[model samples]
Target: MKALPYDELRALYRNFLHSQNISKATINTAYVDTFYLWRKGSKELFWNAVTATDFENEAKNALIKALSENSTGNVSSLVNGYLSHLRRFRLFLASDGTAEPSVLNQGKTANRAYTRKKKMDVDVPYPSIEQVEFYLVKWDGLENYHLQEDALNKLFFELCPKNTDVIDILLKASTLNDFYSTNIFSIYPVAKHICALDIDTRLKAGDVTLVGDIQYVTIGDIEKNFYSFATKYCSHHNPLDYPIYDSYVDEVLRYFRNRDSFSDFQDGDLKDYVNFKGILIDFRAFYGLDKFNLKQIDQYVWQLGKDYFPKNYGKKNRGDK
Candidate 1:
């Protein structure tokens, strides 16, 4: 098969997908636009015009300058994506620098990262009945969607009868860090992506374990669980009207998933591994929201979907949509 120009290839995809009766959505459009732009704007096209040494030298210099200037956030990722796309494009270009191929070669290189699905372990820790009850009792006077507090109380009492105050338990948790401080509620919300957690501790790889769809908690579990929760729940469940965990992550995810329509799930499946980890991680660094308010980050991702996904997903069965 021939390799086509980036614009032409993308335009063809848009047409093909439209022909397939796919619903037009913002997320869909953005993927096509961005991918094409990335391919067109990178140094990959210079491969035939320059030696690998020259190409590498130029790329390294450019990358260094960008990094030294601290041009390192959303713009940086976009730039990287562009460069990567161009590199792939060069592989398809002729040695003479001619665009010989007129269509994407299907049997060529490995599939793109964006097209692949990742699998995550299924277990995570959940609150015990006593802890849930304790939280509810403490949150009793809090108004509005604090109903979550009531839900916690009920679930806890029903699930774990030997209840204790959640606050005290968290405070007493073995892994509390001096660099950061947080309570049980903070951990749960962070895991749920409803908000961000203040964790002073660093995670040892694989220290956090997921079991039977619930995450098992330990001192090192905070970051993984919180990161997973934001990706899964915040982007899909929360409404935009509510506060976000951090703004920029929200912006990039919404820009790509909801606005771009690249995601298969209408709400972009918070429970999906791709959403829960990769997407959120990339967005956190991409938009430079990693150091910002965690609550705000949650708000943005949730809000993106709140305005759109529910209309297509919540009330319908799988076949209904």
Candidate 2:
């Protein structure tokens, strides 16, 4: 197999993304992150030299192990995004005879292993609204005395504003943190795009277009990038108007779904943002959570997820469990 130059292969990947109308920010981020993984796995390995065995080894040795240990499932996002792009890139290579079809079409064992690790179960019991209210009250009282807790409380309340200035500030500040810092450059465009969305229209139509600037920062995962930001923005603007749809929140929904709270609820339904939002609204109404805002509900559900899943919430990480 003739080794393809790493830089040239990456250029081809970028062009492919561009041809598909992928956002510039997303293409750049994917290129950088994917190349980083390639280098880490084997710096000298070329495009044609890249075998299914290499991918399997990388998933097993690096991706799966990291995801198994991390609590927030952040590593899973990065690894999964890389693997998805790799699969697509392989298809590209195979189409042009740059790489052997057999190598890319090997058995699905590696992909299955990655999926299993990514979907680890959380067995903790769900927290009732009463329990969450108790914690909220307790935290409210203690927040005045505890500087860290006070800061977090401020951020939470800050997120509730409908003003663009406030939203921009919060989203901008979010980029300063280690978790989202790497994508700081792309965050501005995302913030602008989100601010331009008509909250009233989305609420009435129940359909938030998950494309365009909303997709600015997201590389391969729509849930993490666009939906995550949109949920926060909408919940802040009007908590009752939108409920978050992250993995933690999904766990809470899954708990109810499994209990047959709504027989119509299918696992696949959660993928559609509009349907997911409706389900959350229904769940809120069903449980009589009118007294609490969706942000409060989000916080409660997130706490429940953390308690059950036991992820490491470092000291500096605020409000997010």
Candidate 3:
């Protein structure tokens, strides 16, 4: 791959700063100037020109020296901002350095990880079966954990380990995140809608449409497609057959597709659970990961996505697009 031009990576850093909630005034006034100075006094292509480890080792001192000589009037803040830019840029690069971070769809924790020279840009080693096992062990080690997502997962299973009724669907919807819950107003009908269907028979049949069927959680006049919520709901019913669809999983799949040509899935196909499952099957077959199940793949990729593509993944209860 060609070395990324200076302007290309700069735009990504700009987006990263936006994600950080920095005001336009600050970005226009401070980030803009610091970036210019960093570009001027710094080496060619800056972070894109070297390994992240190399930057960590030598870039800071190089940055400080460069800024002190060229910048005037309170260089401290600009200097600090540049450093923060580099750190977040690692995250930015890990996600494949899109014009907007969301455009990458997601990648593994290894995407941002430094590699030996001559590797493709943002290229990461796909997890082998052993690596997948490592993540499964990691997941087992975190079982019954009482915090954030794990807390919610534990509460979900504890309340309704089996999806035999309206209450089971409700617990999954409400506890999964604020996106589905959105107060009792949204959660109740979503559960009711799933219960209205012959859930047990559909689950037993391994019906893919059943997931799409449960997703149209209507409230008042508008119909919302809770695609991700639906996958989770069904997966809870039978994790063995149904793999959960998450933004992280989406990103990891997108990354792998680009890196290895594992499947011909477009982004929209992933929103459809059947295609999503098919792609996962293709991924497993291509990588010789058949020894692992879809649920295990879900866990592995989600963890990989968390480490490498963490941007915009914050807040489990985020709304659907």
On lDDT, the leading prediction is 3
Expressed as tens digits, the lDDT of each residue in 96-126 for candidate 2 is 5344323432354433332333432222322
Off by over 4 Å in 1: 1-57, 63-79, 91-287, 302-321
Worst 10 residues of 2 by lDDT: 117-126
* Best candidate (score: TM-score): 3
Per candidate, the number of residue pairs that clash is 49, 0, 3
Model 3: which ten-residue window has the lowest total lDDT? 114-123
Q: Per-residue lDDT tens digits of candidate 3, residues 1-321?
A: 125566765575676656643334434433454354346765454644234466654656656676667654234333433554454455555654334433322332323331222112332334566658878888778644224456555655576655558776676777764633333455788878877886877786678888889878779899887787788777766678988787778877887665445677888999888899899888877767788888898888877766655555344332332
Candidate 2: lDDT over CA atoms? 0.50
Candidate 2, superposed: residue stretches over 4 Å from native: 1-129, 138-185, 195-225, 260-263, 285-291, 312-321
C-alpha RMSD between model 2 and the true structure = 17.5
Q: Report the candidate with higher TM-score, 1 versus 2.
A: 2
Residue 317 displacement (Å), model 2: 4.4
lDDT of 1 by residue, 164-195 (tens): 34443232221221111222344533233211
Model 3: residues >4 Å from true position, as ranges?
1-121, 143-165, 178-185, 316-321
